[model samples]
Target: MRPLRILLLLLLAFASMPLAASPAADTLAADSEARWVPFQLTTGNQIRFRALMDGRWVDAMLDTGLSDTAVSASFARAAGMKPLVQAHADAIGGAIPLAWTGLGRVEIGGLVRTGGRIAIITADPRATGPDAVDLFVGGDLLAGHALDIDYAARRFRLLPSGRMPFRGVTMPLRLAGSNNLYLTELAIGVRVQRGVIVDTGDGAMLTLTRSTWRNSGAQAGPVTSAVAYGAGGRVETDLVLLPDLRLGTLPPQTAELRIEGDTGFTARKGAAGRIGGGLLRRHRVLLDPRAGRMILAVNDAAWQPSRSTSGLMTAQDGRRLKVLHVMRGSPAAATGWTAGAEICAVDGAAIPSAYATSAVAGWSVGTPGRVVQLDLCDGNRRSLTLARFY
Candidate 1:
């Protein structure tokens, strides 16, 4: 599951608009035909599509960052596959015991494949994805096909696999050591060469190593100290509006970026950071992992990416909403909304309860510059009028 999407949505929350369901996996009239599958971008700007896992239709995220298409342990059990404990897998946060199994068949819009690998874990730690989602289609399978993602139109398509001309910057995709995932080197700030993991699964614009954030001396505007949540868990970060971000020889552009505190993640030999949906959403990206190449064409800039309306970044621990970070100049910051404080309620709606959390999250994503009230864990109450930070 994409964590940046969940955290950003928690800060900005999509207006909770209803979306039409993706087409179910019925037999296509023309099996060899190219099909455009419309995906719904959640309030957090995360992508999801209707997919078929073993002939059962389920909602799944289009996650290129993930090396292999994986299913939750529960889903694997439901599919009647015996999960063979393969040992453990380590991530940015820590290590988790992992299991593996095979799927009978997996189906995308018009594409179908049989006997696929699926990773199984005890639980889905990710906070994103629709409740109906059970699968995360990864890059290993996608690299062999012609996949087109049009963020401007908020849609993606699958074309027949072949040698097709592309109009964009092309880069060689190098696999992360001993893994099927691919990454490229990105020159950020000055003198800092960081590895960019092409991950559409992540929602944040960009998150850099804290050392990189400091060593580069990059100037950011209106800093917000907050905790960001994702599949692995929450981490401390200063959400900043980067004055500029450089990607190789590409033209520099001002972008929103996250500066994360180092948490002792076992970094790949020379790697330093990750690139998620935040940056990827700005382009029409095509990946060919097998051939070790990916193409990117700058999409229309008319689309507005998700930003914090309330200027608050929060995390849900158990039944409570912790105020992990607050954006500078936001009403919460001005009112001294400190990090590590629990939020009792938002807009007069109590949190710490499932329904209440949803209510507050929905309220947060509703609309920008709207007035809302807050009740903190310290027994203090304050009113906040929403405003966009980026």
Candidate 2:
């Protein structure tokens, strides 16, 4: 009887004491520990952030498509990092030689990765700018980390592994070869496509293999031809729109997606395609590769379709604007504009030489039905009525 009485008294006393933290409280505490780091969206819509690499300040890009972290060859030489190994990697264009070296530390948003291998990437001579990317933070360092990107805020946060902040539809993430994260069960129209990669490095909304695009019963033509620059070299691609696309178990609102094409990368491992920043920017995304899961909360449900007015893909060559590709069925294609044709003036104004090194938008972009006149270096003049081709 005394033991029973003592037990009863103890239970009463414990019940009177304060209770421990609930699961909800624990989640809040964990979320509070996450620190937000601001990021900039480049003209190409790629995420760029300032990072400290081996105690040196550097501009870095978050690239999930890359198998390993990389530094520019120029940056490696300037930092005195000697290559320990030479290898080759397959890119969208082709296979390219790679040099691997040891990096002491890479810190971004106070998250540090130490003693990791980094590949050295050669810069393209055609891409000239003082603000070239110095480092690429790749999948090798992102594994086992919880990353939340709020595109509307232009900020991202790092939480403890297995901890996620945003709550929405959670999907399984497959960490495939080279630490690439692939999401499956993506429904484009009525057909379900599997093995879709999440590529933050790519600025396009989505990219499909040539075979995948044809198999989807999608209409041909009205595609804007352009040149995509990457690790190996430049590859010709066609940009189109994908309608009624839905991700795995996500919201039912069908998204109008801008899709590109690449023959090399998407065909590997039976991948259907890859989705990039153009689609991700509409949602608050949380990627937890360690737990093999991704969380997504749609921030914008309304679809904003891009209307290409100029239909001319041009690059600055020396002091002139060089035509890279003219979209078939576009105003430029209907004209005598050909690839390699250089432009001397636009709308009767001579282009300044500084435009060759500037980050300004090309003169080809403008409102629909806008009349644009161009003077070519070949002493030919042409007029184009800018309109939406697709």
Candidate 3:
């Protein structure tokens, strides 16, 4: 990862801390073992250990995209929680009613008691795929601690101060719009200025909101391309070029960004975008889902060579393709290909629309016999042969 990306990650982790402690008083200390407790979510997704709520420890999702801490209504009820009030939440699925419940006391590892509220919503624990987990803890819970998450080891550490020793650069969290926080020092043009959710599930580097782009000083190009998925899904966006954007304190560089118009029903009011595989693949990121904090470690050697080709490459449904962003001068753009072209197969293998660009990075770039065939919806099904970027 570059210095700017590292700064953005640090800022994200720092943003998770609560602005202030809840008025309710409760004291709970960290566990003696201090072992990272992984929590399973209803989505069958599991994240590193965060803090424990009450005697029944709660695992958190550590999502930056969320503005507050959230809990499943059924999980809260099952945990014997009675909320103080009902709050309405607009999720990716739709608007759902939730109950705001307070945990008497919550602890993590060896951390002390911190009083806080949890939003309870209805969720299907079984609905999460085989690898999905059930619970999610947003940024509201991580106000006071310095967090460290190590995915390679599946371990996490939480420190009480912001000055803890770490290998990455730390940056400030800049409030974008109403409830969004942007990591300042990242590459230019990349406007991940929304509250970010460190989601490994998502494939893109930055998921931008159409509103954010309109409000931003960044230059907006044309809606040169479109990406469609299996759920009758299609995203229409323009290629954005940010000249002097900042993530934190790190110097900014020119960056290629995507400006998505509407994410169907997935777009919400509070969050502007998401930081997913596109960013994570560039660094070693650790997330304390419970605490809602994260740490990003840049592997300069790993991605230094690929930095030049970052936005030039496209991945479709996990398959790397030479698809172009019709508007931008992408590799596919030079071939007279436009965006919204359906990438049917790579090397004759059928590719899914959900393919992540990072997954395709494993293949050597510019390797011959690496053909990318696509099926377009422009009335004429077209197939194009493309090369990988080294």
Candidate 4:
């Protein structure tokens, strides 16, 4: 099926009410400016705006990543927007049951008009926490409009367009386990995946699910080093090299990607992965939450990596890890390591920077027969090892 048709069918299946007859186009043209305002949600999150429901205006987040507009059950009950029926929604996290309700009228940026039956689910119950917003406007609303997100200006723009800009190819996206939009084929071998939660709060290249990598024909290499946080907090993964990655219409190229075995894929299934600042920092990204589209303008001013180097590497979260940070059950985890233990020496030599040189350079996942002696120091004295863990 064509991408647009697929999106429409998905929307109609999820909408709770029958499609309402829209007002005449001329009637709407006159009131456009009076009803719409530039909307904003969390930066780099979703597009949101204020809309009138039952004579009251409320804040709503526009998420094309989702199939339908959902309201929190509590908020719906309070607003008397009860579900007319119940429908099942499949998300990356899991299958969610939701009630359906009709929204009288949806006015966007004072110009467009959309009236439909929307799904009403308990927002608090389905979300990780209560702060997870009250309303979600999904792909149903996006089908009729051209949407744009201006990050620098911090505003969202909507234009009435039958077709979206950047007609890239669409791929099936799966998060957690449910099938969604995986990537959009912009050029040959270049596809941009949606529903990727952007967490500027996090500082790393996009994280890939172990299954995502395994299925993508990418190989997991060695874990030469690891980073540790406080109190049993450590993430151990092998450094993986993706042969090529195509983001949107950008050219295909190889990049250093991390393999996360412990990623909470089952918990957050609605997202395929995350698109971080590392990629966006080099491009002007236009996000249309209402339209379910994004445009990436590569920045020539941004520094491009040389053919030999595969972009700059930064820690996933905030903390950095050393060789000792690799935990048990991991390639580095079984290295008989403990946190807070100091390294005294390596290979029967009392060398300075023993911790830095030995731990970072010596250990990896597939290294074979690489034996090295390590003098470990606690608060007391020292202990030595002859064989190294790969």
TM-score: the better of candidates 1 and 2: 2
Q: Against the true structure, what is each candidate's TM-score?
A: 0.75, 0.82, 0.53, 0.50
lDDT of 2 by residue, 149-217 (tens): 898899887777788676888877766755454454466654677677787776566667777776776
Specify the highest-lDDT model's number: 2
What is candidate 1's CA lDDT for residue 129?
36
State the weakest 10-residue window (summed lDDT) of model 4.
1-10
Residue 24 error, candidate 4, Å: 12
Comparing 2 and 3 by lDDT, which wins?
Answer: 2
Tens-digit per-residue lDDT, 92-112, candidate 1: 444445576655677787677
Q: Of the candidates shown, which would achieve the greatest TM-score relative to the real structure?
A: 2
lDDT of 4 by residue, 75-143 (tens): 777778767776666442334567766666655564433455667663222122113456666545543
| lDDT tens readout by residue for model 3, 1-390 | 110111011111111223233664433244423545443322112243455566665545554444455666656767777877765654433344666666566555555545666566654332222222234544454434455554445555455443334565444344334333323323334443545334443333555667766655565433333332211123345544444545444345333455555553224434555554444545545443323334566643132222222223343334334443343443455567544454544444444444432343333233334444444433345433333221
RMSD of each: 8.2, 15.8, 9.0, 12.3
Q: Rank the candidates by lDDT, best first.
A: 2, 1, 3, 4
Local distance difference test scores for all models: 0.60, 0.64, 0.43, 0.41
What total of clashing residue pairs does each candidate reach? 5, 0, 49, 22
Per-residue error at 87 for model 4, in Å? 2.1
